[model samples]
Target: MNPVSETQSQHDSAKDAFFMNIEDAYLTALKQNPVVENGRTRPQYCYYDGPLTDIVLHNFIQVPADNFSEFFSHNHLPIPELIAISHEGVVHFNEMPADIIDEIHQQRTQYKVVDYIHADSFFADPLLALNVAKQRNRIYCGHPTIDGLQICYYRGELPEHGIENLLHLELDQAIEFFVDTAYRLPTKIELPDELEDELKTSIRSGFETIVNEVKQQRRTLISQLLAQAKQVTPKFHDGEPLKIMLPSSRLTTVMQYCSRAVAKAFEKRGYQVWFYMEDGEMETNNLIKFYRNYIEFNPHVIFYVNQLNNLALNDKVTHISWWQDSMPQITEHKALRWRGNDYVFSISPVLDRHLALTGAKNIVRQHFAVDDEIFNTDGDIERQNKVVFVGSSYLNSVDLSRPEQREIVEIFIDKIDNGEIVTEAMAGEIAVRFGLPPAFVFWNLLHYAIRDYSVKWLCESTAMPVEIYGRYWEQDPDVAAHFNGELKHGTQVADVYRSARYALVSHPFEINSQRLAEAAACGCIPLVYDCRDVAEKPHWDDACLFFKTRWELLEILKTQVRPALSPTVIAERFTYTAAVDNFIKHSNIGELSQAKQSRISMFVGR
Candidate 1:
């Protein structure tokens, strides 16, 4: 047989087996709750029992076997007679007993899986389910069922059920599939306006509480900053004005910590430092307002982070942009954007070379250091034996739902498996096809895949107790099981680093991450990804333990990763004080230290 015909046959056989299993499960559900004479022929709502049902509705199993006829009496909704079936007292997605499965196979009735997990199993074949759902309205609902209804609705996939307010069902658990009878009977699949209003009220109250908590945290951070500033020693300089340009208009907790540290460091160095930024705003064309602030502040030097904005730069004002991701990770467009700037700063050597090709006058290689005041283990307690990872999910930036991007990423992974790394140019071609920015496409998909795979491998392979603290990871059951908890910025993070045996640091795009430096500052041993070409910085020497593969990392973990004195000793070079000294020497800023400035200039020139 031809390859195509064989593949088709395999798929057909799989589909047939899946249908058999689902049919058996459905029949078993019916057998438990026998509908009276002709009840099978009569229209009724099928409510399959699942673990989530307990959390979603109070006594859902006790929710009148009379269907929803009396429950939704006053509403104009087509409340069908409900056939409620309890699974052999199962809570999660697991195998039912063989007798129960046999019983289900004996019964002959269409049913729906109440939980999303079961829905996935039943709707394994989208085309088959879509056709079946359309014909009989008694098949597993795929995208429009629950997960991607908003996307499907917007894409004009299923308009037959015109933008149904999913809350109308008033059940906490997602309804897996709907039979045709449910939609055909002109059912108002929406909560009544009053009930919706009540739901909104509850949601609003919860949101407000969270908002208040965040505000309190911000206020506390500000107070802590004020206290720390008083303890900072101010050194005398001829008084040069320095302005630190932030990466974002809105500062996250970590950004706020870094920004404050830099500002304080400069303040201590006798530079009249100010941060000129509008919080929570992204105004690319706000040059007028920016210039007004510059005029008021009258800053001599400006250090921008992440991206270089198109600003009117005069000889009097030194425009320096600190870029992190460089060549092979970032597109040429990013390098081009830095043109017209006075100086370009980068941590990565590849980025420095890439920016040099842009004809940038001064491309200085710098490091993203840790703030001693924020992340040091000065008063830290004894460390535990837990291996912790503190970082955000890599998948946040990528929209994996996009088929074109997903297909490209799949191909990219295959290439990686074949030992061929994807280049920016190759990623750019895929980006062009998808009408996406090449840098974003490259980093989002490739970097995301790298981190995702590495972290999963670490948690699964390591012998030590692994704990991850970050956002969006808890959404995956496999990954979530390893999650200890989330930690906010500031001392909480420092405590996490100090308390853990080793902080696992993995950055796909860069050789190093801020976490590596921060972990070191907190006297935490950093177990890093071994990529000497990327991590060519000599500063990492004697400061970190490296692993080229999962097995190597696992071996390190088994050996009991511990704090080495070198990490803490080497961490001093990455402090805010060292960072300020480096900045002054490299940029030729301030009047006090000509000898120091000359030495730094010569070092940078190398």
Candidate 2:
């Protein structure tokens, strides 16, 4: 082989080895410094000593053209020439076209520039790297790498430390930091008056359109509900006895007992009556049974204790909702509207008047009645000299912390002190005027404030020992001493009334409380609170005793004798039979039956 050819081959081999060593050093450096991509860490090749990319300056502070390089260099950034200054303080480089510069400036806002960077790093727009450093208080810069521009974030805020102390962030992390920082800075541009007016006009037009659509939807819903209600045609039975349905489920014990007594009263009058019972569980099955029974029986009348039930929707049949309590005590405001063949029987005349004022149909002032069999003074019992009160103590249960509740109680107490009868209707009216809950006001007035105060006065003022048989009396240590222990309703309560010589009764609304009648039935003279309404009742003076003040009550206890009214006289008037007769007369149920019979006869004749 020739010596020249061999020397040339050896030189070429040495050059290849030198290049390989340089490549190995580059690869080693890349492995030591990694970059994060889509949450995965990989080696990145950083260019430390190479031709620098041209910096596109974002002059948010509007620094002078000549001072740009010097100002950036002081902050440890590379010096680059500024080719163009945008209308919005952005500097372009690398000889960009005039049209392209205009397009960038129009699309970009000072506040939204950071958002553009976050999205595809501004499509690698080159402005992001330098602009981010200039905007932040603490600027961090690293060698431009193949992975893209590296920005370090330390606990959200950049640290004023060396490069080694800085922490490298992922793409997502960098976006979050930039977005947070960008929002913190104030916006540099303001919209023109014309543009601002246009935006407001557009928003108002859209809002009005939405409101109209919603109103149309609400009207459509109401129309559908009314149509559905009209569609329900109840099945009527011909030539059969007029059936009555008494719903006895989901009621308080007193209501349940009253329902039973009413059912018996109807049965005694030669009308078929049925009690619908439910135990609360298996509601779906019970409802199915209820509907099935209702369809088969085809009742002429459905009686409810408190508020109107769903049966009111069946306009074909008569619905009698006998309210023993106040309207607000058992139902929401919407239930006040009674349409179709619905009858509302309120115990208190005040409540009946309120119902009439609200345009409620068939509003009857019905007094509560007692079952003569259960309440009569039949059993032989020793009578005691003490005055007895039977009811719950609501003072312990009332939440007086609420301003509205406390105010209601205070008002009721004031009325009682003034010898005024504050009825459930008055309480409900007060609740509406004050924007308070009606049920809350009524309950606190009757149970908590009035009753508690009355009982306290009766027990504390009288030298004679007073007996109280109810719950929560223990809450007041003074009242607890007079508490004779709890007594079960009906037979047990009747026995106590029979044993007592005088029954101390205090009612804020009417003198027609069932308790007063029950005490009278047991031959116990009722010592009631004196009110003008009491004088209005026939033979009220013969049946019970009345006092205006605690001092008057004390004087009565010491000197007054029991009334001359007999137990039989009280029994005949306040009995369930008499109540049912009164209900039929006032509610025009007899007239309804005659009308039905006339219609049937006319159809047969035709």
Candidate 3:
């Protein structure tokens, strides 16, 4: 016999045996009655009997035993002169009623039929039950006489009988029932001490075999990954200058700009820097490519954004993971453990504490800086009397079905309305309590809720004309009316900032935003939402105005004047050069500093 044929035969035999067991269980259940205590039915054979019945009845219209004749007449279906009603309320016909049966079968094509099985017939093949729920039109069973089940109607003009809505509820309930039933254990049985001891020994041996198999599989996977990494040729030489490698990612556009700025900063400091391009592959493939790049470049330092997976690749090389976003915001890198040589940089103190709690050893608090070449102005462009906001509207993407996410958005709105600060820590604590994804709660829900509320309030309450420049603002008609055309990332955004007299900066977590730096560099006074604590003393505080509430922001727009700082001063203070210096100061990269100083001395002597 062919091997494939033999394997298929074995599978069929096993499936037959499985269904036989279900049939036997159903036959045994028919002979017993459910125990009733305090007028409530206690399920004896299957634990899911009660819940399944309730779900079926809730989504379907059940015809009582006495009303069958009236129902058949009302629906214009012929009823047999003599019919037998079973204990389960299924109608059975004696003698051949071929014409009537044909008519009933024709009705099945137009109306959805749901079989409401009694407790005695409560053996549901979980796969079949799920398929029925997916159909959203029918719940099929065996012959009415065999299963002793009654058919329920799901077609009607009533709102409760809406097929789509009812099927959604049915699908959710059926999934829960099947999942719970699959995990339930059978009733315990008493056995002889010698027999039980033998069974325990057999189970322990089987468990050890499974554990060994898992370990072997893991080792094989690692070996395959290492082999793939070794196929690529090295990209650097042995006698080259000290090198820094920055791997590109598709996580966000902001990360891409930051990487370019960092590369330029290191190049100026007399270090060879290069960016490893990403080819838009799967994450695992990208990870393999990253390993290959590590082996090829052999750089002294590797800088990445929000990724810590390659920290343990080499101990001698320094791995810098600058987390501009919060830890919870990047879900993919959460499981990667940090190494000793890994330097983790966070923009917010709240995020720093979060990393500490998660056992990160070397964490440095750093602020984001703008690329001077892209965000600087020539002091020639005419400044407009307008305030510009450049960000995507997160509120339009919110799913209100999730109560926990909706509650977080409401809390942020309420706080903003009452002239109170909604900090990142508060949103993070609520996310932890509700077991919700922190990124969704903080960034998507709370962040956009605040933006929507504040922007709408500013447009309606004050005479100041505000213009938005991003996507999804059209979701709200009122906000869309004030939306200016979208601007491109690099020079266009800088040009707009240079033309505007004021730039509105709203952050979800009160963290240092790149927008503040960019706006200030373009000589635009930043109107920042007051959420960060005063102790942090953000760099832009001296060059920008802060507003705590909508009222305060209104007053600032109406009365406050721009700060006295020049664009050159603000640009020098917040450029990527200053940012990289701060990073090198915190990091112990002394050799690069010495090399930079030597180059400066040579230039001065020349």
The best candidate by TM-score is 3
Q: Rank the candidates by lDDT, best first.
A: 2, 3, 1
Give per-model CA RMSD: 19.2, 28.0, 20.6
Report the lDDT of model 2 for residue 543: 70
Q: TM-score winner between 1 and 3, please give it.
A: 3
Reference-based TM-score of each model: 0.52, 0.55, 0.55
TM-score of 1: 0.52
lDDT of each: 0.51, 0.58, 0.56
Deviation (Å) of 55 in candidate 1: 37
Candidate 3, residues 1-606, lDDT tens digits: the string is 111232342233211111112223233234343434456653222111111222222212223334433333333222322222223432222332446445555654333222321111111232223212222321223321112111211211223322221222122243333222211111112222455677856644544454455446545645666665435332333334567888875434677778878899988977788876544221212444456456666676778876665523555566777877764534433444667667788876656766776667768777778888878776578988888888777755687677866777778777886877666667678789889877567667777777777677656645466888876676677788888755767788999899888888877555357788788788888887776653255545567777767787888888856665653465665677877777777664665445545766776699
Considering only N, C-alpha and C atoms within 3 Å, which residue pairs clash in candidate 1?
27-104, 28-104, 67-82, 137-179, 137-180, 168-190, 168-191
Tell me the TM-score of model 2. Answer: 0.55
Clashing pairs in 2: none
